[model samples]
Target: MNVKNVYIAYTNCITPLGFDVDSNVQAIANGVSGIRLQENSTLMTAPFYAGVIDSDKLNTAFAALSDAKATRLEKMMVLALDPIIKKSGVELNAKTALILSTTKGNITVLNENAVPVPDAYLHQLAQNIVDFFGFTTQPIVVSNACVSGIMAVSVAKRLVQAGLYDNVFVISGDEVSEFVLSGFNSFQAMSDVPCKPYSANRKGVTLGEAAAAALVTINNSEAKAKIAGDGSINDANHISGPSRTGEGLVRSIESAFNEAGVTAQNIDYISAHGTATPFNDEMEAVAFNRLGLNEVPVNSLKGYYGHTLGASGLLETVIGLESMARNKVFASMGYDEPGVSQPINVLAANLDTPVNCFLKTASGFGGCNTAVVFQKVNNGR
Candidate 1:
C-alpha cells in the first residue's frame, strides 16, 4: 500500500486583524497588531489587552452567509470556512469529512446563569455548522487544549493517508469571553499589555479570539503546501504548566523530523508557539536547542494576534504557508530581546529569504505538544 501525500489546498482566517488570509498577511507585513486594551467590564473588572473581533463587522459579514441565528464563534468559523469550501468545489458526501477544533466552543453560553446550553457542548456546536453546510457525514471534534488546531491538521493528514477520505475540512476557532478571560486571570496569566513572545520583558498571555480554516486533501494541483510529517506527544509534566526540560516538545519535533526524513538544517523557518508566557517561551527555546535548531529563523505570531487559544496553531500555520509562498519570514512581533535561557535565533525583523520548508509547533495545557512539517510543492499553482 502506498501512503498518500497530504496537501493543504485552500486556507482562510477571520480575526480582528482581517477577515481573510491575504489581509491578515498584509497587516503583519505592515506591523499592525490586533491586540488592544479592552475595557469591557462585563468581561473583566479592570481593562485588559486582547485581540477581539468586532462584533458588528463579524455580524455584517456573517449576514451574507446566513440569516439564521448563531453564536459568535460559530459565525466566525463559518465565515472562515465558507470561502474554502466554495473555492474547493468539493461535494459534501461520504468521501468528505469535517473536523472542528476548538478549546472553547460556545463556552460563553455557559456564562448565562452558569447553566449549560445545547450549543455549549462541543459536539452540538459542530453539529450546527454541519447542518448549515448540509454535511452528510458525522462531524469530528478536536478539543485538546491549545494544540487543538494543529492537532486537527495532523488528524486530517492521517485520515486522508489512511484512505478514509479524499479530502478533510478542518476549522478551528475560539472566542474571548468572560469565562476565558476569568480563567486566565485566575491563573494570573493575563498580560495587561500586548503579549510579547520571547521578550526579556514579557509578562503573560493576552487572550485573543479568531477562527481559521483549511482544506486538507490528497490533491496537489493548486496546492498551497504539502503536509510532509506530523507528531504529537504529551509529557504529562503538569496539568497546566509545561515540562521544564521541554520533554514533550522535543520529542514531538524529533518525531516530526524523523517522519519527514529531514534534519534541522533542512528546515528554513519555524513558526513557534510563543504564547509569550515565561515558561512556554523558555521551554520552546530548550526544545529547539536540543534538536540543534538553535539558528533556525523562528517567530511567534502571538504578538499580532495575541493568544487565540485553539485557533492559534492553525492561524499561525496559515500564515506560515503564506510566508513560504512569498519566500519571506515575518518577524516575531513584540520580541525585543531574548528572554529564554537557551540560544535560538528568534526573527527580529522581516527577512526576505528562501522558505521552502517550515515547522509549526504548538504546546498547550496538560503538557500536550504537536509538531508538523510542511513543504512547498515545486509545481503548485
Candidate 2:
C-alpha cells in the first residue's frame, strides 16, 4: 500500500482576541486574554468570565461575504473557513472534501426556539456550510467532544492517505451560549475568573467560543507543519471525569510517538488539554510524567483562549505550528505555581527556543482522548 504524506498549510481563527491568526497570536504574545466577565441576566445568576466573540464585530467582518440569514454558529464556521478555502485554489470536486468538527453545532439556534430541532443537528450544520461554499463531496462531521478538533485533523489525514481525497478543509467551532454556560454551571466547573491550567490555585474551566479552520493536503508546498503521528483512545472510565490513572491519555501519546517513530525526548513542546479542572489537569500531569515527558515544557492555551471546547485542540495545533516557526514558546498564561501531583514542567514564561516537534493532546467527555504529533518542515515547501 502506498502512503501519502500530509501537511497543514493555511489556518484561520475567529476569536475574541481578533478575527484572524496574526491578531490572535499577537494577543497571546502580549500575554493578553480574551476571557472576561460576561453579564447576562438569564444565562447565569452571576457574571462569568468567558471568551466570547462580539456579535457586532462578527457581523461587520462577515458582511463582506454574505448577508443571508444564518445561525451564528453557521456564520462563524463559514467565516473561519472562507479565507483559507479561497486561498487554497482547490476546486470543490470529488477529490476535495469538507470536514466539520464541533461538540455543539447550531445549538444556539435551538435555544432561540427554532421551529425545527433538526436545525441543530450536526449534519445540518455541515450541510449549511457546504451550501455556502458549494462543496460537491459528502460532508463529514466529527463530534467527539473536546477531541473533535484534533480528531478531525487525524480523520482528514487518513482520508487523504486512503486516496479518498487530494485535499480537505477542516473546520471546528463552538459558541458560548446559555445552554453551554448552564451545562458547565451544573458541573460547578465554571471558574469565577480566568482559568489557570496546572496552577495550584486553579479552580475550574472558563469556556470560550471560537472557530478554527485549516487546509490539509499532500502537496508539500502548502505545508506549514507535517502531521507525523496521531492516536485516539477511550478509557471508558467516567462520562465527565477522565481516568485518574491517566491510562487512556498515556496510551494515546505513546501510540502517537510510536507512529511518528520518535520518543518523548524528540518533542520540544506540548500543547496540552488542560481544562484547569482538578481531575483533567492531574490526569495530564500523571500521563506526561509516566511517559517520561515531565521535563518537556508544556502550556495550555486555555488561559488565552479559555478552553474553546471543540475548537481548542486544532487552535492550539495551529498556534503550536506558528510557535515553532517563530522560535518562541508562549507562556502558560495564568500559571504562577506548580499544581499537579507530578513534576511535569509547565511553562511559566515565554522563552526563545527552537521547537521542531510538538505534541497536541485533548481529553474530553465520555472518556475520549486524542494526541497528534506535528513537526516543522524546512522551507514550508
TM-score of each: 0.98, 0.98
Candidate 2 per-residue lDDT over residues 1-381, each given as its tens digit: 666788888999999999889998899999999998889777677888999899988988788789877788877888999999898888989999999999988887676675778777899889989999999998999999999999999999989888889999999999888888899999999889799999999999999999999998888886888899899998779998999988899889988899889999899999999999988999999999899999999999999989888888888888898888888999999999999989888989998899999999999999999999998888634
Global local distance difference test of model 2 = 0.90
| lDDT score for candidate 1 against the true structure | 0.93
lDDT of each: 0.93, 0.90
lDDT of 2 at 184: 91
Residue 96 in candidate 2 has what lDDT?
A: 91
Question: Per-prediction count of colliding residue pairs?
Answer: 0, 1
**What is the TM-score of candidate 2?**
0.98
Residue 4 accuracy (lDDT) in model 2:
76
